[model samples]
Target: MTAPNLSANLLVELFVEELPPKALKKLGDAFATTLANSLKNAGLAPSTAAVTAYASPRRLAAHVTDVAAVAADKPVVQKLMPVAVGLDATGNATPALLKKLAALGADAAAVASLRRENDGKAEVLFYDSLAKGATLAEGLQKAIEAALAALPIPKVMTYQLADGWSSVNFVRPAHALLALHGNEVVPVSVLGLNSGRQTHGHRFEAAVDPVIIANADSYPETLLRNGSVIASFAERKAEIARQLAAAAAQAGADLKPIEDDALLDEVTALVERPNVLIGQFEEEFLAVPQECLILTMKANQKYFPLLDTAGTLTNKFLVVSNIRPEDASAVIGGNERVVRPRLADAKFFFDQDRKKSLESRLPGLAKVVYHNKLGTQGERVQRVAAIARAIADELGGGELTKQAEQAALLAKADLLTDMVGEFPELQGIMGRYYAQHDGLPAEVADAIEDHYKPRFAGDSLPRSRVGVVVALADKLETLAGMFGIGQIPTGDKDPFALRRHALGVIRMLAENDLALPLDRLLNGVFAQFTGVDGFQANPAALSAFIYERLAGNLREQGYSAQEVDAVVSQQPQRLGDIPKRLAAVRAFSALPEAAALAAANKRVGNILKKIEGTVEARVDPALFVEAAETALHAALVEVVPQADAAFDTGDYTQSLTALAALRAPVDAFFDGVMVNADDPALRANRQGLLAKLHAAMNKVADISRLQ
Candidate 1:
């Protein structure tokens, strides 16, 4: 294939009202990517074309290099119909063929040029033609429409255009549309706006009323110089980050901006020209928890709270202003004034919440519904406390059970607190603080806070044994309750985050190596909801769901699917032992005898599965008539005891390694021995020997999966 030669850089922009700040970056990315993909598919741009996306608060734009003025003509080969159908026995054109030809813009005169070939079953007529290339003007219009339709807009606004009657829907009200190819204007229209070289600059600081982009390559430079707008989202965000660091350095040696990508992106969308200004509030607000002050500043004011070397929140914060005035004092002072009320509200909530003990707030929880089917938070707390106590008993009953019960009881009490009600993200955090203030045990307070640990992937696990117990109980209770009510997760829709809860339980069990059996733990949680109405608990199904999550997580952690399948197929009761089994599988896989033993094990399993009744693992040596069977029996007698001892001691790697000695005898036996012997006694004995070998081989994992 030859490449198209005529190409030029293309620019397209949609100037509109302020876009949704949180979705600005996504919209901009989708706009550029979808448009570029469409143009490439349409042959109007090379697949290798470089695409650059730009987004500010009021505009979304894209610049593509090496876009064709017109797409290359594409050759099309379309199958018509069978020759017998298209032409009669007399070989004259039929009405069907004529109609088909007419639909393709061809007439009878073109029939002589049609190609005929056998299409497997019969001779078929094929039409060969060239599809016309799309002009740049037409292609740009389609690209723009597709890009707009593909944007991840949170919502659409429908507004009347200047025509007064006609209306268009977009993420925001579109005011201008610009399209340029090289130095020429490409005529296209969208959202009731005609494409031109003109677009508005910054609302207050532009040097010109309309920035006239000369060419596609000059869009960013023109906007920066004449429009006083940094057009690129990435460049603007980087600039803000740089300025924030510089400002922090100027303020103190150890100061740094609170690192948050979402906040930075939102602030970037809010400004075209970023001016970093340092602002300060009264240090008295620091008396409140740093998290409250930090959340208020970042969430309400979009300010980056500065932190010291010890990661302590300072009274100073940085503001990203849209304008760069000679004196930044007004901007700084205004930001400081605007933040005072928000900080005071946080302080008030904190103070009011501390007035009452978290224990006293427990009764109020009955007013808050946990789930429609799951009863009130007060009832949910009781269930969690019960589960925690059971788990603590399994781990090591005593002070641990007491602390876990206390923590689980107070865990949901914070939901009624003023601070947590105002900031739900601080649910467990506020609980810890209030528990400490109420003179609760330190471990109890810590457990209350850490119950929600490892909230997401790669998050930390609970540090205390009581915390671990409580966390496991809490997550298991959620799973049991949700699944019991048939609110199970399906596909991508998990309203209750059941997948996350399952993974949390898996992490706690595996990472902590807790001796608790998974089935028993699940059954314990399920047993707690016995008398609750509308509760249809399925312990087996919930266990399956957890195992599924564990399998996926193991795959993500770099374990091969075969190894995971081998270990997980057994449905081991202890999730903590799965890692050891997987490790044993890996070690076994490297041994020279692993392949033959795995294949033999698979064969034995298949043979045993077909048996009508129970096949015991008792081998009487006198019944073994074949030499290979006798050798296999001897090998088992020598190896099974050692492997069993290793397995019993939790040395799975050694257990699996010990079975390597059976490869030679097992292979010879499979090759020589016929399990379906003429005598019933001989057949039964051989089957029994194979069962014993299978049992020994799979003590750690189902080695058949290795096959």
Candidate 2:
């Protein structure tokens, strides 16, 4: 393939044993980045760069293009080894330099040739610099190796060097190594495999002697036509989607794309010539819960299911296979065998779970650990129930709270059963089955099942208030319990998924329109936490940590990052009060002087922040020399009461609006009077007046936090 109109080029391929779908996808993207960044750091770069990544079960390839042939070369600077002891400031080498040269196995003649500077200090500097327009191949190779070295392959192995060197360790046995600069394979070696122009195609199709990959364009098509596998992930995905629809049409059904991209990526590896064939399951299996059927099809069978007009699932499945089966009977039978076991497992679990009441499962949860330090799952249920009841009563759900109390007590009970334990993902799901079996109200059973959603972004939300309450309570306990032990998600490591939990809380409140203040709720969780070493929780520390979660949560909700910053700037963030505060600030954010107001507040803050000597706030009204100061004082007198009322009533917009009334008077005072005037008494009064204005502005938000 000719060099595809690119300035520079990049190609990277990992030939590994079958890789997990999730890991392969992650590594594919990661490999692209490593290659691009590697080029940048080596004084090498691309005019335009694109990383095309693809992965099958056994191999991953990242191709970067439009890169410079050679990275801009860097100069290697060499400085004479620290003036070789005492040289008496002469131009001759000292005894120390003689000893070092002898020790380094360097010739004395070479050291003598390294002369001193013209200035005559016995030290000289030399630089080995490479100018521009050099080939970037060597630099690119080094970058690739660096990136590959640090890769996070959770499972790795070492392959013995067939070339008689040490074993090469990697995620899988890297069958072959390939790196290309446009059409040329950059010579490098890894895992005892030489880098070259040849790339092997599909094992089933082109398993003979290696095929030559002449260039970039030729590589993919050649692989597709003869190699029989499309190594470009985008191509593989499109083909899968196309075939799925075609097979659905042939089977007289429609396939809806499941909301499981990870599953899609995983299935991609299990196939080369992705051919979707629609198959059928017994219609009676529909009696299983929709979730059980869908999960079984998607998770176990790697099949996509079809639905009827009323939205009930039809007895159809979409089977994506690696190789097309000519007769299709064998493929159909194999898929049925795979799906039948899951369906049977779901059916058996459904039947077995119903033999006992949700309440019966409660006692078993005591044996399950919520945390080694935080009692049992049974204990957690009690805590969640208490919080849920309080929240329900707050929301005027007095009747519902009592029912939710019953549900919360048994919400996690199903966690102890064999089915739920085996399928930990079906926590609330199993609870619903067990609840319904005991003839509890449908609302309660539904709530038990629906409590943990929308489990992910764009996922479904809880329909029942009972579910919402339990969901909130459960998340609250997690945040609290984790925080109590000083375990919060930081960086990319959230061993407990605390960030997800926080986001879930934010979604529950916003999507459900619960509009509950998170302060009181987060505070409640903190209250239940006993710190490490069995120490009672420090209410102060817990409050600070939850504030971080709240700020992060707000930032993700399309709230301006600065708005979250401003709201969090308040020392004691009132969780129950933040939503209203944020709303008020958002409403005022676009007003003619909104940014000015925040700027003014921040300016006032810069003054108040540095109170070297205590300045009393008793502004001497009698000595108000500037007319603007008196005008500002008059506005505060008029606005304080109304602003306070608005703040208390959660009418943040109104509060900010009322505060803005002081802007004109504030501008007038600063325009005429020096805050630090020569007259000590007048300066004191001016500072006090400014402090008063700042105090009034803070009711809505620290305003200084706004942009």
Candidate 3:
């Protein structure tokens, strides 16, 4: 029998064919975490045990420190039936009790050892037993099975084992499985493969056919020394980044690889051994838009495009090779040759696309259906143009109106261009280039591209006034159209990216501090869809949706939820003022009187709500039977003008601060006056006094939310 206290580092590896590059990192992390957590849960490892995860193109491995060979025994107490059911009138065991004991590997002879205890309602018979611990072999087998079952495989592959009779499903066909506790094989199986101490390394650069891991602690070094592979995914990615930077510096001063974490992860997942090499295409291909060339190289060939100090794409790029050769000239030359044709293709698309102006492509949009209920792209463009014109007029019409309308019309035209057809991501980008070629106004050309600004969170808003107007119109049309057709996002199912569109609109308005009212904007955009069938304009629903998105966004920016709710709950029409209002609320919350005032404000609101009808702010001075009421009324007269002046000038912080003086009188009034008095006239007068206080206090925000 294995010693109960025996402990050692454990190693597990699943060797297989290449995994999906995008999903490799997630799979490795999940496998290691799930396996370690299972052992910890089963009491085979301590909660503080250290675990390390490693992934290469062909293997996923884990090393866990200080795992036990056999779990410790634990005591368990199980409740049998009530004492009345377990015993007879003669104080003898019943047959039902005997049956339950038998299932627990006990018999009637053990009845004397049973204990009686109250289980909340009645005295019940309890049985105590020691559960035998699980051996490492048993625990590891379950852990391996659990780990494989929990992998986030993008897609599963089914294949037959070598024996041809058995089959299994995994991310890829399993070639071998390696499991070890210290230096001993743990005897586990997964994906039709038995655990062993051997794993293959790099395809061609490895010094051995099957590298042998002597112990769990030596797995990484052993694989690296004999197999010519870097075992850790993070370490390999870091090495690639270092090499890319060095190569870029050597190529030229101020040159660096484009920054894309996703691309780096994918490249790391595609190789076991990384060797960064410099490759170049003809400088003539640089005439094509750098975006097109850079995207093709990165997306298709997994190459990193180098950029100059000015952020201009250079003729050179970096290639991460899977093998390290003494002479990398052939590899570099082969990459250059392969990329030449791709650049040529980009050039071809650019040349062919420039033959027609963006205005000429406008007719092509009619053939493309945007959404079944929302009409074609051509119609959508018209709606966006109309919204842009109305918004520009609101902001002061002139050249701005014409530029915004022109930009909106030409924005979606490039979606029909050859370059954009090949690369859908180049939709707005290509529009700007083609507009420039067609000799349109620089403002209009820039707006065509900038209208798609803030496509994702943390992205910049439109750069100019025309751009902001057009972007607002574009995003608003999408939101109004989708919400009007009842395609609102529920849960995570935002197929149309309506959430992103809403966020884009919010960011533009708030970040740019545009003077547009949200209600008016939504109504105008919804009005654009009046004649379309199956379109019902619900500006209220759209406004609520935008405000909800704004609330979440504000909270994420580090404001307390109470502060955000206080400002957002009012559904302030001017979204640009949200930041100032939130600042004011936060500042007001720090005051000594803030808490008392908030509670008093809440009390006042509750009292007013209980009344049958609206309580006017007008109060009769003659009805002030209590000094507290008179003092409160006198304080409001002193504070209202100062607060209103600050508020009119957009000094929200000062506006909220001015109300702090009224907290004392307000508290005293609530303490001394009975709002619902026996005299109807007096009670109504008191409520009106409270109403005036509530209105003045809540102008900046609903301070009651701070309560």
Candidate 4:
């Protein structure tokens, strides 16, 4: 072990081909451990050494600060047992040894122990250690080289070394090896680059190499001074952002950087000394829709979209190119030329979409298949329309009924249009545009557009009640039809995105305060599929499927996973009702008197749970024995109407509040009364009271489920 006061640090930088960000951190950790462990395993430990690994798109480096001038001498080594295991086991070694000797035709003289025998037992494993006063330069080189060669090398290159340059692979060719100890270059070689006192900077902007580096401490500053590309990921990112903002100002607009960090990081890689360029397109392309233009720039060409002060799309755009252009006019011209064809295609699609009314396209959807189990998009639209009509009646029809019908009929029509088929995301939006173009009512157009909303979790819900009803109707049919045909979602495989559709339905109802029963609507949606398409409906199975999904949807909305499970278990009713009930139950559970109330409910549930026969749960007040049982029965009688009214009014807090009334009576009854009495009538009377208690708590949800 070295003295505790050693101070010379060993800094090894592998300026090899560029590396992926993920690999850089891993290589650094591995290098540091290898440096420390290689020394530690040899019974040698250095004082105050830290291996810090940071990466850019280009290089992987490990810097050990406060390392000893020399490595600890003790070395970690692997001693091998040359003999085979089959020969070494048992006392029959003589015969087994002879066989192995003859098989390899190798003499026994040089055959080392194939395993180490600590305490006279065989161990094929080797013990590695570090020795004190070892060579720092040797250990650093070996560690860096071994770690590099061990992992699947990336972005590799070869160089001429007094011979022909051979083909090697890396993110980039290893440029130079720079290992330093206190401003002195440590002579080492890796990936064909010998350790040097200098390094290169920016490739095109400042292609300086062999620029002397004082030490690892001076790396960042030296690169900037010598016109070299400094290996700094954060620095590169900030520079890109700065250049992008400046270019936006130059173009007389505020540029909106796509807020995806991963995308930004990827764009950073293809540049060095980024030169931001501002360009503009013809205002006529604006007729092609903002989506088309933005996508054409951001997704297709990696250009940034720019907007005016009022957040309106300006004709201007910003782009980051790798190097500066002497004549920016040529660059601007080239970008404009490349964008013209995309704009032309967009304009052509826009013209084609308006050629025929969206209503005229409704019949064209018949050719498209929904799925092998489900009917075509045309048939699905019909199902949506039917369900929409039913939901409208339930919601108290007005303009909503007509709006719902309009949206449902034209919803899938866009799937038949060339423009929407090319851009599935623009389905509802395009449908609304086309409907308006066809002189449809504004309200109807709004519903049509809003129907496809909340497509993903946390996405906005349908804006109008008509839109909400139509969307629910659409999703319900998919869920029901798919379930009827046995195309139910499985682990990680909701290929139909049934989970999303189901969640969307729940969100729509909850957000809009719609009180429609989930089970009834589900039944209505699937009833059209009875014996049609050769798929039979199992009502229980389909209802249960929806319940599970509803529970999953609620759980996704921050309800406890266990709480969701508890509610579904107790109230397994309509899929839509449970979310409201669960909120009530969860809120009730968190209250001061909740556990006591739940305990009373549990007493009621536990008795009812055991009574399976038709007569077991039937109430008969005539058989009531104890005062506590009678008191609890009377308490539940009062709570039932209040609970029902609360549920009826969608006042979840009120429903849960009324149920808490039975807590005292329930607890008193359980404390004083015996549920299983010696007389059958007395016991039956107690069970009946318990059933009533269960009913009181269950106005909103299954009381048994809450706990």
Candidate 5:
């Protein structure tokens, strides 16, 4: 069959064994993009060509419209040697020029028509020709090879081809390769397989063994009609979601399948033709914690457990089966049977874990090494308890400290439980369950779970004051211990998740509006590691690391970098004050006088930094020689108290606003007075006055940072 011109579309499919469910969509997208890009780059497809990617369990495919059978030829340019070297002394073609021309498929006869242009330093000969474009067959072959090479295959299988002697490596063993331009089969071969217009679909349900693709444009419809498969990954996923919702609604209006994009993507990859089925297990399995039941069902069986309106896991679940039968009871029954054992195991682990009180499991932690240099989990627990108590005492000294200490002691006890051992993601969650079963107070039980609060970005903070205190202490201990042992995170290599830990601490302190000082918390955590060998406290460095995380977090929250820097650069002891400080700086920045004042503050800071000794804010009125200096001192006398009073009461916006009144006098002083006077006493007095001004303006935030 003769290939059609640019009007016809192209279809390419690689039918194979089941691909990695998690990686199938990515592979499909990459394949289509890479292939389309290669074709476009080779001039075989227009830049506006429409590309559609398809992925099913057994196949990956792409259909591109507006593709060409053969690309249009284009001009080509070659930079030959410089003119002086190409031509002889008599301007004849030299041997070097002829040989170079010959290498480029040109001959001596073409030299007379060669064009010369100055290439900056020398005149160079240029050869121009119309280069023949690649045909569809040639471009398709190269594009397929390039696309396969660029796939992000998590793992590859090496298997013998049909020839038995040849082997091919791919994500899965390939069964067929299909390529078509219009109705014509494009002659492209890969992995020992030649291109054809036939591919298999739905191993069990297909009407035909080898589904024949009618044309490039009708592939999806033909596959669905004859092969019983949905070719598009997104379409299949959406269909699954729709079916799941329908099934859930059929059971009850309040019943809904758990929503997880990752699980949906994975299930979409596992099936070629999805049939949503409802399944159920014995209600006795509901005795297990819902998290454990949900985890087992989702992780082991790829089932979507249903949740009630209260978000409590129900005995019912949804299964996305690859087959659709007239009677789905058999399929539903089989899935129910398959998930029962997993639920039973979860129940067993939960029952066995509850038999022993959480406190009884505490001793088992001593056998579990938390870190090589940091000693056992038991020791870490003790340190965390001490830090928690100290922080709680600072927050308030009564029952809060007692609950925090209790919660910290039992936080890691769940690590020894069978349920947590099998599912590490449920460590804190299981700890809360076990703690409550052991008759611990609800506050302590919640804290046991919440000590890992704000675990990931956007995660919620602890729900109670006890949870907050313990969470802060836990994160602080981790940051201090890691930084103390010089296990600081560098570049992308934060294996210990120290950056997350730091951000957690920042979030709790700032978001919770805790009264705890960051430096003191760092010191307390470091103090806990005193007797450990090879441990050196670097609270300063750790403090800086935490502040950097806080700055980044604030900036991510839509605060300007200057606003964040102004507040973060002060190294505010109490992180709770940072929001107020940032708000104050932002407000100050909008005032017309703010720029001049900030500049004056920056200048004053630079002058003060140049001196060897500290410039105390102890100024002498008698030494104010310049009228401008006298005016500035008087302005400070009026503004400083108002600013300090507003600052002391947490009215940061008012405090910064008060400083705006000094902008004119400060500018006048800088413009009219020389701080570096001939007399050292006058210079010292002037520096002292400037220091007072700096102290007043920076009470809320370092205004100089705004500059």
Candidate 6:
């Protein structure tokens, strides 16, 4: 009878000083994954073992299920020397063979059972053996060491151990290590701490001094009931979220928490026993921009600001405290007291910033260095204004031109504002507020704020035409200036975020479907850099960079690689037309004749490329000598005009569909007529006929790529 496997659930915890809040979650995840993976690699844990990670402000823990007491023995095959090298004329084992066998812990007697196989050219001998399984104690120690070594610690600190003579580098000072297997303590050591069942919990609110974890399955329950801590990171985060929603609901039905995942994550890492408390500030502080107030609350204090149904910030906010008390008035009052000074400082910055208009800050930008080689922010503003003006003209010269230029000039003026200086993310937002306070045109103010829209993936684009023009110009100027100075992005090293700027430009043009040609816009930007020293003009390289980004963007939008390659390979000047071109390619690919036509188009392109000179796409009917050629020429005469008309009218699908009539003629011509004819006139005429066919087939996209 076969024996059943002996297995158990294992738990490990590392008690330490408070970990860095930003890195706590990642550290917890890395700790659990590395430990589990190492155990699995060592065969001490099943491949399907369940791993649960626990993290609190003062601890990191992991619980793995179905770990074996010892791994099962595995069979191994060892390859030896070839038969010719291992044996002599008498077919007896040589000294080399004896030595190889000895190294494998086998003697000459084992050679009789050796297996031989022809490995390509010659026969080689191999030995088979069973490797002994590793014990759980040894495997667990190795897994713990490896997991500690693999932690993604942002910074390491060296601290002396209790021994006072030795020091270790770690993310934080280590206090205790707890390792348990099933219901028994597993003797293991890490970071100068021995394994134990005791661990400390909440600094002030624990039900017991030392939480006794009875078993691997009881770790979280013990910590919560006795230690007054929620040990699981995910569970604690969800609990905080639930409490926040409930608190917001209690405040008012129309009120809701300002949703920010990053803020929630940061707050989650800051507490063990989360207690939501309500706090309020003076209503006069709302006179400051809500963005300023909210940034102060969220960034400085880690508070969740409440908002009304109209999305307006209220005077009250919720504070997530680590301790729960019968009467929470003191906690709420303490938080309110701590936040009053922060709000007052924000108000002071706002009042000081509003003392001067954005126009007044224009000259100050000349002193701000944007880049050491690219001159000052003032110069950049001028360049952006020039490009915006040109784009405005191309988009339809009118009020847009004036608004775009004005917005571009004032866009960087916010860099000199007190609020923006205090919070760099508030640059554009503060500029809009200041512009409106200065009584500038509403379009100009909105454009200034909207120019930096679509700042990230899935973000909204500019809502106004003036904003679009300025946004395009702003991104273009960055691309042109950076490329001019030879600061091109290489591999993953884009210090200037040039790839993001290129994507922003592409999204603006393609998503907005503006009439501006990409090449023309790039040239306009390059023109603004005239007379700048050390600036090289390489429009083609910059154009290639933008097109590469466009190709990736198209593929991410779910277009097939072939479709994107076919369209982008042509370097279409109007990016706005790409979606239509892709649609046309998709529609054409679905047609019954698309496959044959694409293959034939590829064949035609290869033939035309081999010719010594340009093949004019002008066919002469009189020069066609074969019936196949004459038929193809007649078909072209009838279909080319229809396709051209459809193409001119922007009916790309219809244009490609019209060329489907040439498939039969194309196949017949290739089968019966030789493209490289014996006579020069016949060859030239055939080449012209093929060139005409090629041009018609590829008006929307390079259909040959479909092959």
Q: State which candidate, 3 or 6, has the greater TM-score.
A: 3
Tell me the spans in candidate 5 whose CA falls farther than 4 Å from its real position: 1-7
Question: What is the Å distance of residue 589 in model 4 from its true position?
Answer: 3.8
Q: Name the TM-score of candidate 2.
A: 0.81
Residues 290-358 of candidate 6 have per-residue lDDT tens digits of 999999999999999999999999998999999999999999999999999999999999999999989
Off by over 4 Å in 6: 1-5, 87-93, 107-109
In each prediction, how many residue pairs overlap at the backbone (N, C-alpha, C within less than 3 A)? Answer: 0, 11, 0, 34, 0, 0
Error of 1 at 538 (Å): 1.1
Model 4 agreement with the true structure over 318-380: per-residue lDDT tens digits: 777766768888887788788778778878887898999888888877888888677788888
Candidates' lDDT values, in order? 0.92, 0.72, 0.92, 0.68, 0.91, 0.91
Q: TM-score of the candidate numbered 6?
A: 0.97
Q: Estimate each model's TM-score.
A: 0.98, 0.81, 0.98, 0.75, 0.96, 0.97
**Candidate 3: lDDT of 413?**
93
- Poorly placed runs, candidate 2 (over 4 Å): 1-16, 29-51, 62-144, 161-166, 177-187, 195-199, 206-217, 253-259, 309-311, 457-461, 488-492, 509-535, 557-562, 571-630, 645-650, 667-694
Candidate 1, position 139, lDDT: 88
Please report how far candidate 5 places residue 612 from its true position, in Å.
3.6
Off by over 4 Å in 1: 1-5, 88-92
- Candidate with top lDDT is 3
**Per-residue C-alpha lDDT of model 1 across residues 502-570, encoded as one tens digit per residue:** 999999999889898888888889999988888997999999999999999999999999999999989
Segments in model 3 whose C-alpha atoms lie over 4 Å from true places: 1-5
